[model samples]
Target chain A: MPEYASILFSEVLKILMLLVPVLVSVAMIVWLDRRVWAFVQKRRGPNVVGPFGLLQSLADALKYIFKEIIIPASSNKVIFILAPIITMTLALISWAVIPFSEDFVLADINVGILYLFAVSSLGVYGIIMGGWASNSKYPFLGAIRSAAQMVSYEVSIGIIIINVLLCVGSLNLSDIVKAQENVWYIIPLFPMFVIFFISALAETNRPPFDLPEAEAELVAGYQTEYSGMMYAMFWLGEYANILLMCALGSILFLGGWLSPINIFPFNVIPSPIWLILKILLLFILFALVKAIVPRYRYDQLMRLGWKVFLPLSLTWVVLTAGYLMYFDLLPGN
Target chain B: MIAHAVVFYIFSFIAIVSAIMVTTSRNTVHSVFFLILDFISISCLFIMIGAEFLGMIMLIVYVGAVAVLFLFVVMMLNVAQQKNEWFVASDSSSHIPIGLLVSLVIFSELLIVVGGWKYKAELQDSININLNLNLTNTQSLGNVIYTDYVHLFQLSGMVLLVAMIGAIVLTFRKRSGLKTQSYLRQISRERNEGVELIDVETKKGVKIDA
Candidate 1:
């Protein structure tokens, strides 16, 4: 009993250790996204807060906390309130299986990648529920768009992940990272990597595929009625999901915690730092994509997912399986 | 073992309650939400019983994709306002007793099966594909599915492919009279075709059309 208690206590401690930094990083990511956007648009972004606007996100949090949460009179109150909580919780929970380095993950379960996939796929629920519960036409439309969009992109993402799994042989995230000790999967699976990245963008409802929350037309999309902390929760959850996608991309393709090169100088740096660097680099690319690309039309987005990415990734999966089988390099063979 | 039993009971209870709510909820959207809850709790039960892969797959396929599709249809059709009057509506009053009788019969059949299984527990041992405790759930599933049940697996994949193609064919339409940008025409334009230079007289405009 004592041993069990100690294990439970240590697990809680580890979760705190992982979560605290992640929450802080989510805040910083929000600030960084704005600053990056401002730089691209040739404007000074949030210079009044702490040095270089480092504390801008904190100020925004405080502002949101003090603001009144206005619930719509005709809305379904329970589901309206539950939506943001679900979004925030689901966004944070996927981190349970993400390994920063060896022995760093909270839950080293066998189906870690599937757990992430499952949790991320369920993210549409929050948006759909919020939109539906709002009792408005725009939010309902937004929810419908989100449902179709997420479903379409997830098919291609599943196929791409299958391509990776064929090479790795295990669903475990750590095992995937370990398999890339000598060479990253990105070198061999470059096209799938690109598809996965773009799909990740679409999956997270980022710019260019953020049709769900297209502010210009849908008037903030599913979040049309959300206000105050509830709205802030949605914001935080969005950034967290973006960060999660970046981490997932790095892990699946960029070799997780592995160094770029296997040389002495490259290998000396710590693994977790390498993972962090890769995640940041990916995040920068995410932000830059947001800055450069125009928002996709709904039909075009659907076409890209179903017509282009779906067939391309499906073919890649077949090619990958054939290559592995031909060379007798399939794992666990 | 105590904790395992406790979690099992909790998940099963939630699953049962959500399953009931799924059928009983008046709001169609609420029913879909309850259905999602039911799937999630059942997946939790599966996970507790050492089927993590199946549990996560349940979440990914059913709660994630299927339920979202349900919500999409519910919202689009504006069916949330429909009052769920299963047996109470005036026009539907005649089928109430028959429906109840049918449900009772099914319930009793399930009860009989469970009671029989409890009495003859040894009969359950005759299963062809036994769970191998040595391998992870996914690994064992892969082994059996790829080798022993390969044809069935391939057949299911073909079924899904046919369904997908059928859905696209049913919904796809080629609408005429809509103006769409032709990339070839846009890209193939030359400077000579687009531009015309002419010397005009002092006050008269050139007849460009001619």
Candidate 2:
């Protein structure tokens, strides 16, 4: 093949490789959660679907594609339709910046962390618009709750990230991962790790912090009026965000692609494989928490965020900065 | 480079148009939403400027908090169209002339400044912005405040503290409906006394309970 053609072919192959894994992995996460929930509740979940419900997500996607979409008479038709699209699109776009391993990122921007934050922040608008456009009280309340939840959790998240940045001394995701060759920052910044994990749970609006979709109270929250493909998009976007958060947690705290064992025998798994294992483990941990923990009341949730997590993360930032300064690692120290 | 330029222009165009619509729109709620769109696009503009920190902060602070607050207040106000007419009508008549004049003045000033100066783009580019540029626009603005601008920062903190105290003093008032708890009152309460068991016996062996 000619050089240009070869380059183009390689690029296409790279895209295919990245995209296939992400899609399959996301589907697997959904399946795993279902299976885990079934085991926890002492019941079989979707065993009838292809080989212990492995194909359940594929079936779900097909169902969504063929389903009838109903636009409410009272809704602002434009915004109502656009909301889920925006939500799903923003969620997918953030994945472009997330590095799976050393050479796996799509965009590989210098400021990957900042880019991710920016994209995730925009994700809130989808919920806000969905609720507002619905012209329904339940969805509106859910949207407002989501907005507040995101804002409160996002602050602590930022502070925790500051702690990480202090350790890594670089904004690039790859550099941060590489900095963990000797040791992961989690050893020193355990408090920040916990804080970041909790904040991620809240930021993604997962169970115990999912006031936006508190079915008992808000009638499915922001997606109360949504059905068919639009609803599915929101659902996928949410799970994608959950996966993203888990991936981020692994990368930041657990050492991105580093094998746990330093010995020769355990070095069988490649770096990317190690990364996948860590992310999967983290995802299971998240799902376990969701399965076990009861939902927090709105006031209690806000209090935890603002009073507990914020202060802890801020203190972590200060401590990390002090340590870095003492060791002559901080910028301009 | 061309791709980035195109993207910048596209977002800039949307931002400008949305901002114009925000001011022009009769529906206050819709206008508030347009303002949000404008903020998001401006954050994109910040990204184009290579100010990633500022862009992220703008999204987090402006889009995530301020815009939400605006939406909340706008939704709660429940002002009808008739009430809106007063503000909207007055705004339109007064705004057009003032806006035009202001834009004209700004454009003319920009033209004069650029025209009067001999362009030294290279010299300006060579200047280390990381050293000279004030990072106030960054999310790490707090860091710079404590380190470089410590004295000014301390003064600002003191001012804010005083303001907070003054606000508290101003707002402090005794009201019947207001609920306040004293730590002494709280601590003094015995848990055993807070709960009690009561028993009552009624007529015969019919076992009527009270």
Candidate 3:
């Protein structure tokens, strides 16, 4: 029994280790987004808090912690509270299967991809419930729009994932990254790569696809009623998801943690540097799009998801299958 | 062993209570929230069963999509007021006959199915697949769907496509007096002519037109 206890304890510790970096990275991303936005507009962002705004996220955390939570008079109190927790928890839960380094994963289940996709899909509930429980029209409208957006884009996302699954033959994240060590899927599957990146942006509800929270329309969307720490939870969860998507894109297409700079003398810089660099590049791409593009209208966003991305991804899936079949390289064959 | 059993019992107890709350809650939104709790319990059960795929699907699909849809539609709907009749439908005289018939049918069906099932409870222990190392279920499911169930799958896709198109056609209406931007016309416009400058001076007594 003590032996079993020790095993469980180690597992818990492993999970906590993986979680710490992800949470910290999410905080860093918040700072990075603000800084990038400031730089684009030629203004200094968060310079007062700490050196180059390093401690800004910490100060914000403190602010959220100390602020009073306001529950609306007519709102369902229990659900209003539970909604943000659900969002935060679902967002964090996927970290269990995410491989931060080559062997540094909390859990390595066979269905890790499915697990990540599933948890991500489940995040909509938190938004919907937050909107419904607030008993506000704007939140309700935001919830409805977000739900439709999520479902529409999710199909394309699934197809893009299926494209990757075809090459790897396993749903494990570690295996997927390993399969790309020799040659990243991006070389052979560039079209699908583009589709996946765009679908991911939509899936995370980032700008210009962030119609759910369009201030001109929905007045802050599903999170209008959330304040203090609960509001912070949603914000953290959104950043965490962005980090997760960047990591996933790196793992799938960019050869995660594999050295793109292959000069022999500096090859010893550790694999995680390559991984971090790749993820950072993708993150910058996301921020660049936000800075450059205008917010899309709701109907236009839906058209892009369903009409453009879905068909493109589905075509890529069929093409991948055909290529694999021609080479007789498919699993089980 | 006792501690594990105790924890399981506690989780199961909470699950049952939450499920009861889901059905009985007066507030529709509250019911949906309880449903989410019920799904979390089922996910826990899936973790126990080593069927993480199905468990996560329950979370992603039922709790995430369907339940959210339910809550969204329910919250938006305005319910009519009516007198409370909580106990009127619960009288034994009104329920016993229907309850007996349901139990009898369910029991008989369970007996027949259980008797015919080839696999035994003991056999399942040795037949269990390792959750981490195995790669059989999802792959095989995909294989069969692509091969044997190809027609059915394609048919389902067509159905979904038709339904989606039908929805788009139904909801898409061209409003009167709404000017829409034309892609071709916009693209073909000469840049120099697209914008024209008009000069005018505005002053209370010295306004002039050019």
Model 1 regions more than 4 Å off = A1-4, B84-88, B97-132, B179-210
Best by TM-score: 1
Alpha-carbon local distance difference test for all models: 0.91, 0.83, 0.82
The clash count for each model shown is 0, 0, 1
How do the candidates rank by lDDT, highest first? 1, 2, 3
Share of native C-alpha contacts between chains A and B (below 8 angstroms) recovered by candidate 2? 0.54
Query: Which regions of candidate 2 deviate over 4 angstroms?
Result: A1-16, A327-333, B1-4, B79-84, B87-191, B194-210
Give candidate 3's total backbone clashes: 1
- Candidate 3 lDDT, tens digit per residue, A1-333? 898899989988887877888899889888888888788878888877888888899999999999998999998787799889988998898878877668777787878888888888888888877887898999988888988898888888888888999988888888898888778889999998898888888889999889888878888999998889999999998888888889888888998777764678657888877788888899988988888789988778888888788888888889899999999988555
DockQ of each: 0.83, 0.41, 0.57
Recovered share of real interface contacts in candidate 1 = 0.96
Each model's fnat? 0.96, 0.54, 0.81
Residues B64-84, model 2: lDDT tens digits = 777877887887666586456
User: Over the stretch A38-117, how does candidate 2's per-residue lDDT look in tens digits?
Assistant: 77778797677799889999898889989999999999898899999998888777777767777877777667887787
Q: Could you tell me which residue pairs clash in candidate 2?
A: none
Residue range with the least summed lDDT across 10 consecutive positions in model 1 chain A: A139-148
lDDT of 2 at A252: 88
Candidate 3 residues lying further than 4 Å off, grouped into runs, are A261-263, B1-18, B80-135, B140-210
DockQ (0 to 1) for model 2 = 0.41
Tens digits of per-residue lDDT, candidate 1, A1-333, equal 998899899999988999899999999998888889889989898878999999999999999999999999999999999999999999999999999889877889999999999999999989988998999999988888988899899999999999999999999999999999878999999999999999999999999999999999999999999999999999899899999999999999999998998889998998989999999999989998899899999988998999899999999989999999999999985
